[model samples]
Structure formats: C-alpha cells, structure tokens
Target: MSNNHNPAKPLQSILAIMAHPDDAEFCCGATVRQMSDAGADVTYIILTNGDKGNHNLSITVPELVKTRMKEQRAAAEILGVKDVIFMGEEDGFLQPNRELRRRLVRHIRKIKPDLIICQNPEMFFSGDRYINHPDHRNAGLVVIEAVFPAAGNPMFFPDLLAEGYEPHSIRELWICMAPEPDHKIDITDLLDVKIQALRQHESQFDDLDEMEKWVRERWSEENEAGEQRYYESFKRMKFD
Candidate 1:
C-alpha cells in the first residue's frame, strides 16, 4: 500500500500491448503513471488503428485512424511512455494468428521488456454484462503466446533469429481487468497524472463531461470496493 519506490533510477522496462488506442488508459492508466513516475521506461503497442471508435463523425477510416494515432502518441507523451507502435490492423476485427504472433514476438525480442501488461482473457464476468471485447481477448491471447513460447523460444521464430533478434524472457506480466488478480500496484499519489494521460485520448472519449464522470466513478469504485486497494490488478502468466 505504498507508492514509495526508488524514484531516482529506472526500475524496469515495461511494454504494454493493447487492442485499441484508449484500452490501456482506461484499464491501467494509474499503474502506468506509478511506474513511469518511479522512472520505469514504458512503451505501448496498440494492435489496431482504432478507426471504428468514433461515432457520428464525418472522418473516413484512414483519417480517423490517423487522428487516433496522433492522439495516442500525445497521450503517451503525457504518460512518460518512451515509444508507441501501431500494428495497423483493422479495428474491431483482431485475430490471434501466427502472423500477428510472429510480429509481436519480434518486437518482444527487440524491446526486451522486463515486464509486459495486457488485457484479461477469461470470461468470468461475461454474464454480468462484463463481456470482453473480441479484439481485446484476441490481443491478450496473442500477447501471452508471444511473450512466452514465441518470444522466449528462439526456435519458434527462426526468421527473427536470422535477423539477429535474440530470444528474451520477460520477468513478469500484469493483465489489467483480470478476473483473478495476484498483483496490485498502488497509484494513489499518481491518480491526477493518470487522469491527465487518459484525457489526451480525445478521440475515444469525446464527451468530456461523461468521460470525466465515468473515470471518477470507476476510480472511486476500485478504491472503495472491499479488499481492493487503489491499484491495477493482474494475473501473472507463470511458465515453468
């Protein structure tokens, strides 16, 4: 329950993989703030162009994608993220395929992140209207696969090996919105920074008033909910 980490030095390099532009901000913004504030290098890889996110807007698909990417880049700057990568896949239609997995593995090996953050794949809350997005689930599965056997196993991607991309093992993974959370990061001191970073994604949350209210309510719920401290929750993928 303490936000006191060694702030003078970088603790770890974190790579966050998500399906859309604002998914990370909505789910793990506070955790990102905490880690960045403590000098941890953070990078984000958005799997889709987020072209379908806008409603009642006159922009074309390419234009919307461009706009969202710009917004995400600005948001990353606000969150202290070192780099942002877009996979250029179509929005709302992601699939966990070998091609995507290979691409992710190459980046994983290149970045060599100490930790990776992603969305949950389980369906525990589906009945209660907490149905996970198909794109999110697919991305989560791909990320898990890429982080383990694909990225960590050099034999899995021989093309990467030929290109001098060495296999790298990540120390840990944090899945935001996990059905079962084994890790919690305290973000009380960095809540305002989280809000600011999230606000940068103007394309996703166009209604300023509604977005602010929703964020506040969610934050309050996460804090006041029993036995759940103000933190980002995740289930670590343990590979032996």
Candidate 2:
C-alpha cells in the first residue's frame, strides 16, 4: 500500500492556454497573479502569432509575428509565468483539428498541470456586445478536448509515449469570460498586478487611458457581483 497524504503537492503546476497574445491577460490575469503568489508554477501556451491584431501597423506577417512574440514574452514575464510555448499556428485561421489536439495533449502531458485555464468555448456573450473571437472559441474547444481523453488516455497519441510524454489527469478547469460562471477567485490585492501585466502588451493597449478605464470598470462590476473587492470569475467545466 502506498502512503500519500499531502494534497498540495498534486496542485502545484498550472497551465493557461489561449489563442492570442493578450487573451490570458484580458480574461484571467488576476487568477494567474494570485496563483503565482500562492507558489503555483504557471505555464502558458499561446496558439497564434497575433499578427492580424494590429490595424494601423504597416508590418508584414513575419514581422508582425516576431513583434507579437516579443510582446507575449514580455507579458508572460510580468505575470510571473515560468515558461511559454508557441504553437506556430497561423493567426486568424485556427481550427480545431487532430494535429492541434495532439500537440496540446503532448504539452499537457509534459507539464502535468493540476489546473487549466482557458477562454470560454461557447458562442453566447454576457449581455456585452463583445462576442468572443472565433479563434478564442476554437482554441478553447481544442484545449478542453486535449484535457480529456487525448492527454489522459494512454492509447491515444501513441507517439507521445515515444517522446516521453506521460498521461496526466488535470484536477480542475476554469473557463474565463464564460456566460455562466461557477467559480470566482478573489483578486482584490492582485488587481493592480494584473493591470500592470496587461500593460506589458503595449502594442494592444497603446490607448492606455481607455484601456485602464475599461479594465477598472470591468473589475468593479465583477467586484459588485461577488461582494468582494475584486475577483476573476470562471465557469467550471466537468473535469470527470
């Protein structure tokens, strides 16, 4: 009989997988900051180059990709993320395919994250005219699929075994910007940290005044809804 009583050891690693450079910051920044402060190791896997994000820049695809990658690395550093992986998928054209799932599964197996955070996969918006982006939805769907049988099943993705990737069962999944949220993490003290981290992506938030106002208002609304100072809300998915 094996004796294992410490539960905290199993919950150390966390993974945040998103479609674009700023998706994680916009959606779950506070949660990431809180988890990092709590000593959890967080890793990010970005699925796109975010080359199509800029509207005014006269940059080519390769140039834009390089710029966005640098921005993403800077943002990750500000958020205290330990590692980041890029999928090298084309921006604005991501699809939920077997290849993507396999790659995601491989990473999940290697990282063995206890908690996975992602954007909402559903189409409905939360009374805000801002519909979630298509790439966000696609990435979320594939991430959920990878967290399931793909990463946990030994028979699936057989090549991963040869690559030394083992089966990993994630304990919980939190989907940000979900229409219906079931879990809320109090981020009262971490709100500023989150904002500073988001500011690292200067390419996206060149209009700092407007972005700050928007984030403050949004966080205020979330605070009112939860009766807390600030929090990151999420809809918990069925993990079993």
Candidate 3:
C-alpha cells in the first residue's frame, strides 16, 4: 500500500484500464485531464471493442466496434491522453484469465505507470437499480492481478521479460466508483473538458445534454459532504 496520504502530489504517469471505450470518459475524464494538464503522461487501456454497446439490434457488431474505436480516439485526444490501447476483446464477454492477465501485464510493463486506475471489481450490483457490466468487473480484477504479482514479478510473465519488457512496480492503484473511496480529486475546473470528451462518444448517447446533466449531478452528490465543488472519488491502494 501507498505511504503517501497526500492526494495532491503529482504522479509522473497514470494508466487507466477500462472495459469499454467510454468507460474512462464517464468515470475519470476530468481526473485524466487534470493529470495530463499538470504535465503527467496519461495512457488508456480499453479492454474491449465495445461492439455490444448499442442496444439496437439492427446495428452490427463490426460497425459499432469501428465507431466506438474512433470515438475512443477522439475522447482520448480531448483528455490529452498520450495513447489509447484496445485489447481487441469482445465486448460483454471479457473474462479474468491467464491470457487476459498476461496481456495486461505486458502493458503494465510497457507503460510503467506510477498510478493505475480502474473500476471496482466487487461492484456487481447497485441497489437493484443497476447491474455492473461483467466486462467492467473482469477488467478491474485483471488489472489488479496484473499490477501486482504478474507485472512486478519477473517470473510471472517470462515471455514479456524475454521480449525486453522489464518488470514495473506501480506505486498506487485507484479504483473508481468504489464503495469506500479514500481519495477525492476536485475536478471543478476540468468538468467542461470531461463533458466535451464524453460528447465524442456520440454513438452511445441519445441525449448528450441529459447525459452531461446526470454526470454533473452524480459528481456533485459526491461533494455534498465536502468543501470541494466538483469531485471524483477513488479507492486508493498504495504498494511499495
């Protein structure tokens, strides 16, 4: 776990691992913008193509995948992200397995990000109102495993080491939408950037205005007990 209690310290690099194209934008776009704006290198790892994102049965998976990939690139550019890597996995069917962990470990080694951000793996259900996507939970668990023993231990992924990717130890892991968040980043100044980034994913939303409003209200609710105007909260786990 991390020894640093101060959340304001600037991290040199940040990597966001998410299940779909717009997950990063919806969860932590402002945070990514803030970090990148502060001169930190930011990268995105999208584990799925988001082909099954559209509810309309008429839309084909290949078409949706291409559109989602394009939107992801645009969104990443808007957030000042240095790179957006797609794992080419089928949407809605991600699994936490050795192959997935090995792939994630390779990226962890290659990126060597100081901070790794992802979804909450344990958030399966939310008060009957919503059910967390299986892909999101799987991606979270995969990243958590990859960041720990797989990425840091040289023996875990021997092929990666042989391929010239060195073991990289992450300083912190940040899980978004966690049940208990220990860190909150005030993102009032970057809210507009986040909204704009989300707008890039036009294929997913029927009404962008409503989407933006819901996001704003959600984040605002997180700040009702704090002094921060608009905030993004995360469960921070520090590792040596």
TM-score of each: 0.89, 0.90, 0.93
- Which predicted model would earn the best lDDT? 3
Candidate 1: deviation at residue 84, Å? 0.2
Give all candidates' CA lDDT scores: 0.80, 0.82, 0.89
Better of 1 and 3 by TM-score: 3
Prediction RMSDs, each to the true structure: 3.1, 4.5, 3.1
- Clash count, candidate 3: 3
The reply for model 3, stretches above 4 Å from the true place, is 1-9, 222-228
* Model 2, span 1-240: residue lDDT tens: 111213545447889999999889888887776667667899999999898888875677787788788888887887878998999888889998999999999899989998899977786455667766789989989999998878999999989988889898898888888766887766667778778878878878669768977888787643445564766788875454
Cα lDDT tens digits, model 1, 1-240, are 355334443448989999999888877877776778667889999999998898855778888888889889887888888899999898889998999999999999999987899987664355566767889888888899898778888689899999999999987777887766776666666667777877888877768668877766666634545643355567765432
Those runs of model 2 whose alpha carbons end farther than 4 Å from true positions after fitting are 1-10, 222-228, 238-240
Q: Count the backbone clashes (under 3 Å) in each candidate.
A: 0, 0, 3
Ranking by lDDT: 3, 2, 1
**Clash pairs, model 1 backbone:** none
Candidate 3 local lDDT, 1-240, one digit each (tens): 122334576588999999999999988899998888778899999999998889898888888899999999999999999999999998889999999999999988988899999999999997779999988899899999898788999999788999999999998899998988888888888888899999999999999999999988877744466564777889988875
User: Model 3's lDDT to the true fold?
Assistant: 0.89
Worst 10 residues of 2 by lDDT: 1-10
